[model samples]
Target chain A: MDDLWYSEYHTPHVRFSVKVSRQLHYEESKYQKISVFESPEFGRFLTLDGIMMLTERDEFIYHEVITHTAMAVNPEIKNILVIGAGDGGVVRELGKYQGIESIDVVEIDERVVEVCKEFLPQTSCGFEDERVHLHYQDGLKFVRHTDNLYDLIIVDSTDPFGPGEVLFTKEFYGNCYRALTEQGVLINQHESPFYEEDAKAMKSAHRRISHAFPMSFVYQAHIPTYPSGHWLFGFASKSLHPQRDLKADAWNALEIKTKYYNTELHQGAFGLPNYVKEMLKDE
Target chain B: MDDLWYSEYHTPHVRFSVKVSRQLHYEESKYQKISVFESPEFGRFLTLDGIMMLTERDEFIYHEVITHTAMAVNPEIKNILVIGAGDGGVVRELGKYQGIESIDVVEIDERVVEVCKEFLPQTSCGFEDERVHLHYQDGLKFVRHTDNLYDLIIVDSTDPFGPGEVLFTKEFYGNCYRALTEQGVLINQHESPFYEEDAKAMKSAHRRISHAFPMSFVYQAHIPTYPSGHWLFGFASKSLHPQRDLKADAWNALEIKTKYYNTELHQGAFGLPNYVKEMLKDE
Candidate 1:
């Protein structure tokens, strides 16, 4: 009962810790180590490979930002593909949109889904939705082989390490570009710009995606559980620009109540800090 | 050094850890325990009462945010009063403006100033400026008695606990309201809205200040060393509105080179998340 603290090293010299009341569940999945813990502050939270994935208190922000930004951009979005969000939080957010006809989630690990379903029902609730098709396979391979094109593709993978490393490759980005329709918008979890390792990944992802897509940009969000609490998401598309093409009025008409994502903040989030802008520019 | 990790309990359940290479110094002043640690990631970071005050790596965002937002709104600000910024980070930022006439800093703990001067010179350099006047006294008492009026007042105090608890009181805010000129702007380190305790403080500060000032608003910044990485600052003024009265061109004409704060972000930082907006709203 004493000294039960779960800590994750954000960098070699920086770490984040949470005092665990008890271990709810733990299993070394084929892909990584999946564990769930109960805490008074964050509530029941899940971690994959010793890193925080989602917590009950803050999961809404991450899920809402990842899902609603693209949905708001393309109100007519029908088909969507989600990569590596096995917790089903992304699917839960997409389920809110009645216009979204089909959602294909490509997760590398099935254990993440099963464990989340058992221990974390809040984020896993939308897995029961009929439109959500769960494909337990590697996301890198999924984007390469999938014949059906999607209107919006969201890559909700981990950092560019371990199993998530392939998801950031130029080959994978090219495949995502090809798997998308002409008007398709590609968004991925670009790493933070503060730390050295993450910044390198961020710049590399931008370089690759910028080459594949005609119009590409990076937006930022404050996700406390992540490293440095400053997180970035990449937006790349063939034609649509986020600011110019953002139909704020049209999206507001949907009246989808969100905790974090708003039409104005959507535009504001894209107003990257000057340092981040410098990092994203071709060097 | 192998097992040396400095951890701060963000909440009862959540903690943040940094691998300390060595302890720079430690002393218990009349007010609180002040300690400095050297780490590879954050360089030398200072902590008060076992809580992180600032780190060398991310101190720019905090100092830039606390000072420039108000300065940008009121470009004609000349006489400024800073309360509780003993580290001199706020003064260092104010030193950038050549138009600044006199900068008065009121701090309760002389130990914080002396220790930071000996160790954290990057932030303490501005203390040597001839225009900068340092007062090693209680900020709450200084504002009550000082007859001089200031165009801008920056409250760079710590969280509303221990020695900082008095700085967030209604009486203290009323004193600040009196000490300010007709067009003066008051900005304070409003607590984060993510955690419950900090959210309570944030709401209380907003409610009290909103009642005191004719025009009041809350702006946000992403400071990772902080509890939630999402931190807030209160902007209360006698007549000036941050957005409406913002002289972006005037501020830009000054050509103060900054790494974080900019005129565009001066507008964007006020765009709070939906939940934060709800928290700030009168209940």
Candidate 2:
């Protein structure tokens, strides 16, 4: 590899590139193309279908934020169902909680799990926990078939396009709503609010999620590796306001240390800027 | 002229690029290089010394958050001193408040202001206000000579390498502390914490500011064009907590139609992630 560089077009006119040391692994799975690259600054990163999924250096920010944010809101949450989190980063974060009884992960392609388990043990190590169950199937069908089982449903899917397009539909969100317990919480990887395609996806997901769950809300985190370095997440719950119902004291008592997620930041994350609020509210 | 793409290396290994339609203007100022570009997605943007300053698209987030965040903390802030904001964006935001009596902007390079005033009136129009007085001199000397004059001091300087390096030193911070009134607030463009070069600057600035002001704090905002898309700002005051002192109702009643800054976000912006908090505290 002579000065190998990987570039992703954030928009038609905007591009972000990384200087790669070399390609560690590349393979075509049943669902998408997965590749691992060794980079100097970002460390080793995994990409799916030419889109960035996780990098070893910054993956903790995304995984810890998504998992601990919900756990802090409802400390009693025992059962968690993660969809499309084949990298096992979300499951790895969930395993930190002693109270979580069942960690069910539904990944469409088993190859993603196998690749991660081999190359990315930092996250895939969660699979060793006795509570985790890897279900190799489609998440859309899994949620539609089940009812009132999970306390939390985490949709950690890829970008809302191609094979992952079905995950953003209103029908899929309705099924997630039905698949959750009374005090259920559904958190998804809402797309970026920048760029045309990402903004379109973000708006659509928020609209669909709002239709299924009346208590849908959005939060932001700065994941520098993402499209805009600014990313949003959808938090839909039955009757919990993330800020108002935050179990800060209770969560603090648990002493679950985190790099990104904190009680003060949990309240702050929900404080969307006026522009993003207008975008989400405009429907 | 043909397929022109402007790329800024965020780190040696990480690069961010935009497809440029054309170069609007290019010149060598007495201090550094100044250039402007027109891009499809980012609109028109300015760069000095091969580093991005601001773009028409997302400039509001930077200007608004920097200006309004401090204003909400102290609604009575009438005198402001801005350093190195040659683009006039800070002055434009400062002019929004009728109570602000004086805005003294110090830019070492006068050509940067002339270029922006000619080609970037969206921000440079701020020079129209009678209260704004531009002093084309060193900000370090200006602060050193003045004492107890400004109610707020905003250092919107470039990165801490070139001529702007003096602004991050303890002596300069001590000068800024002395150049403020009793209820003074000092804010500066602290660098990012991800990359090594940026993290070094951020830590240095925080360390220097803490030595001058007891109430030194750091806040974050998502400005995607900058390095790593995770930008930090320093807020040092005599006796004020950004979140606790935020006059949300007072600021809201003013009916300021802002695109990014909001009362809720003002409180939230100061809630740093644990890692960043640990980084700042580590020094």
Candidate 3:
């Protein structure tokens, strides 16, 4: 990897990118980079974008917040399918539940998974977990084939304009609806609400998801290294509203060492501002 | 004023400025840079180390969470003084209560006030209000002149290295105690908790404030544009423990347009990660 640039977003977290690995196995894309570093406290890091998407210590926050929030609301969540989680962070988090029978991860880039297994072992822990299974295939193709099976589906994809763009479209959302059971829940990593276009894209995605699912909503979290230091996640469920009134003690019993996503934060995360609420309504 | 850099914390709300004014009207400082820009939707933007710190659109989340949490616990609150609040966002928020009698804003840079008034009028509204009296002077000197007077004194200074360094010292905390009435509350804007040195400085300041006052504590807020998205504020009071069982109606009645600060958020902001809470206990 070569030709890298680092921009100081906020203090410790610097967003940087290097060239695609010379041994890169994936098809060429407009912009793709391979970079790795280690933080003093967060351990090893690997990001698809120049942006530091997650620290090794805090990756659970994004994965758990998306997975568990839906799982808690949809108590019958047994079969889970994760889309584009090449890092395996989502699958790792999903494997925590005792009730979850099987978890399948569909990733387009086998190289990302291979790299994670070799370098980012912490994130790749899901691959080794007995309950988890990996499928090196396009998420869209996998979701289209499945029918009324998965109780929870998580789309942990990259930015919308990249290979992940198809996942944000109406067609993919329709397939997700078809792939889910009546009580199933789907969560996606939406773009930031700070920029107009990102917000618009998220709102559009939310509208499409709402059309397919009974309930859909957006929530926010502070990812310091991300653009504008804030990011939003979109959630859609067939029957559940995604708001769980349970205490942290109920979930803290699992004893996950998460830097951010606590039970108290789970509820508080959904408390949107009037502006965000208005935007959702406008959608 | 010449060679100025104005940082808009919120897109259209608050902006903090560092201006090298030709004439030194109030005091003989090398340059005059004011702290706290409390414009309309832009809550409070503080300038430190020639850099501007802006929170999300929700300024009250940081300001109210810092000020009110301490103030609410201290039942006997009357006179208050805010240091370096050129934007008057804190003062405006403080003005909401009938318990607060007179509020004195001690700002060193009149140019900042003028700029805020001209550019960000909503923050300047604090000055126009009858309860707030403007004192264009040094905060350190002003604190030195009094003993057990103010019920609450908010050190809304910039970063610790610049004009704000004095505000973060033991002497300044001692002066604050001297200026405060018995059972008085004091809250100061500390720097990013992510930076060890800044956290150490804040912890030291907390220790000093604890020595001067009976109780001292630190809390965090998510300010997107700050060095770290997560920033900490130190709170100290002679008698109060800084916890309030807030009624829903009371919390809801605060007529501030906030994107983040709510009653639940007010409590949640104090809930720190174990690492941050552990850092506060260091020697």
lDDT, each prediction: 0.90, 0.90, 0.66
Candidate 3 interface RMSD to the true structure: 8.4
Which candidate wins on TM-score?
Answer: 2
Count of backbone clashes, every candidate in sequence = 0, 0, 2
- DockQ-based class of model 1: medium
The lowest-lDDT stretch of 10 consecutive residues in candidate 2 chain B is B142-151
lDDT digits (tens) for residues B75-117 of candidate 3 = 3478888998777678767876766788889987777677667
What's model 1's lDDT at B247? 90
Cα lDDT tens digits, model 1, B151-256, are 9999999888899999999999999999999999999999898989989999999999988888889888889899989899989999998888889999999998
Tell me the tens digit of each residue's lDDT in model 2 across A145-224.
87548999999999988778889998899888888888899999998887778988999899989989879999999999
* DockQ of each candidate relative to the true complex: 0.72, 0.87, 0.25
What candidate 3 gets wrong by more than 4 Å, as runs, is A1-4, A8-52, A55-60, A68-77, A181-183, A239-243, B1-48, B53-78, B95-100, B109-111, B114-122, B147-151, B170-184, B205-219, B235-244, B281-283
Where does the lowest 10-residue lDDT sum fall in candidate 1 chain A? Answer: A274-283
- Where is model 1 more than 4 Å wrong at Cα? none
lDDT per residue for candidate 2 within B116-188, as digits (tens), equals 9888999999899999989999999998887548889999999988989888888999999888888899999
